[model samples]
Target: MALKTFVKISNISNLSDARYCAGMMVDVLGFNIDPNSSTHVAEDDFKEITEWVAGVKFAGEFHDSSIEQIKEAIKKYPVDYIEIADLDLVEKVGLLGKPLIFRLSITNEEDLSKIKSTLSYLDELTKLVLFHCDNENLFDQIDAQIGFYNGNLKLMKGYGITADVSLGNFPGLALEATEEDRPGFKDYGQIMDVLELIEED
Candidate 1:
């Protein structure tokens, strides 16, 4: 199944999610690689899961790991993209020579301004910026500013996405993969509904 637009599934920890999203034809699958993160995927598990999937790029998700830590992590499991939540670490991570994805959570006007200003200065190496707003209204507010954004990176609305979404100026959307309740059983929830709606005809 092919999706109508670019899609990224983040925090994927299981082979079930990895293979499922890959079959859905999502563009990127993100795995939390920070050792300090509770959901961090170990090298062995990461290899095991990734080995079963094909036709998608992998993102080494780093929330607060230092450059040295990120560098070390990728050496063990190569990733096509580096995903980070901190804006300040973009430059340092970019030096790693991998396409970068910046994830941000905007709760207020101050947060929006800070991200907008910082994003305008980002270089081409920054491939995508995923924004998760506090509410649907804030998501609309960010969507309105897309035309004003002069940066080369693609912008994805990471929040307020529904099954009947109108993508408008943004390239696509981002969603988290749900954890399996039991080893073999899984409940996909709203993600399944949304993906079915956006499935390419």
Candidate 2:
């Protein structure tokens, strides 16, 4: 099966989540590579899970790791893309030559300027910006600016994405992989529901 639009399943830790997302033809499967993250995927585990999947790009998600730390991790865990939350790290991280996905956190109106400024810093190496919000109200506020982003950068909504979301000008939606019930078993849950809702023949 194939989704009607671009989809990225993030924080994938196990083979179950990896294989399932790949089978569903998602565009990207992201793993938490930040060692400090509670759900961090070690090199060994990352390899084992990734080995069983195909046809999907892998992303190394970093939250607070420094440039040196990220460089070291890249050598150990090779991923097609790098996902980061800090805007300041963009230029430095881009120098490493890996495509970047900026995870922008929007909480209030004050952040509008920050988002606008982020657009200017995004270079060709920047793949896309994943906008994550704390609440639906904030999502609505930020969603208004989606039209203002008409550059080469792809923008995705990481909040308030339901089966019926208008999708409008955005290229795709970002979803998270659910924890498996057991090593090889999974409930699929909401990710499956949304994927099915948008499934194309």
Candidate 3:
């Protein structure tokens, strides 16, 4: 019933701040590797940050990039998990024994169908982050999808989750908090509160 918290640190300088805030509770720490993104931290920066924040699980966030690049990053940086937005890249790379979490752009049944088609291939997928891109009523469809996975897959809801709403939800779900989502609070007290609630439940 423990809720795992993942914080995305865009700036490598803020790595210490993130580690300090996260303390000993955070389950995963994410670093953005996309060059065009504002959160983009270089591979060396990722290495330095990971060394500083030892013990806490690490993840690298990637967008539309080549499989070779992704594989290189995984080999060089080597985080516990890799967060990818592209399913094709995931299939091509084959996850390489490392756990993967797909940040999917879910909208309608078609998108879900595509995800379903790839599920059998995503053997390393530990979780799926259902991204709400077009203000769609995704919450309504989640229950059915959860049933479809039948407790085998972990579900993470992204793209509009606030600390308050995140805390309201309980156990067995993953929550990803980006820098843009909550800029001020480095410490994830709100997320920890949610985890505590899940444990209690």
Which candidate's TM-score is highest?
Answer: 2
TM-score of each: 0.93, 0.94, 0.67
lDDT assessment of candidate 3: 0.56
Candidates ranked by TM-score: 2, 1, 3
Residue 137 deviation, candidate 2, in Å? 1.1
Residue-wise lDDT of candidate 1 within 31-148, one digit each (tens)?
A: 9999778879999999999999999999999988988999999999889999998767888999998999988788887876777676776645587988877565677677777757
The TM-score between candidate 2 and the true structure equals 0.94
Worst 10-residue lDDT window, candidate 3: 2-11
Candidate 2, position 102, lDDT: 92
Give the CA lDDT, 0 to 100, for residue 119 in model 3: 52
- Please report, in order, the local distance difference test score of every candidate based on alpha carbons: 0.85, 0.84, 0.56
Model 2, runs deviating above 4 Å: 123-125
C-alpha lDDT of residue 75 in model 2: 92
User: Residue by residue across 95-119, what tens digits does model 2's lDDT show?
Assistant: 9988899998887778876776777
The true-versus-predicted C-alpha distance at residue 85 of model 3, in Å, is 1.8
**lDDT for 192 (candidate 3):** 50
Candidate 1 colliding pairs, count: 0
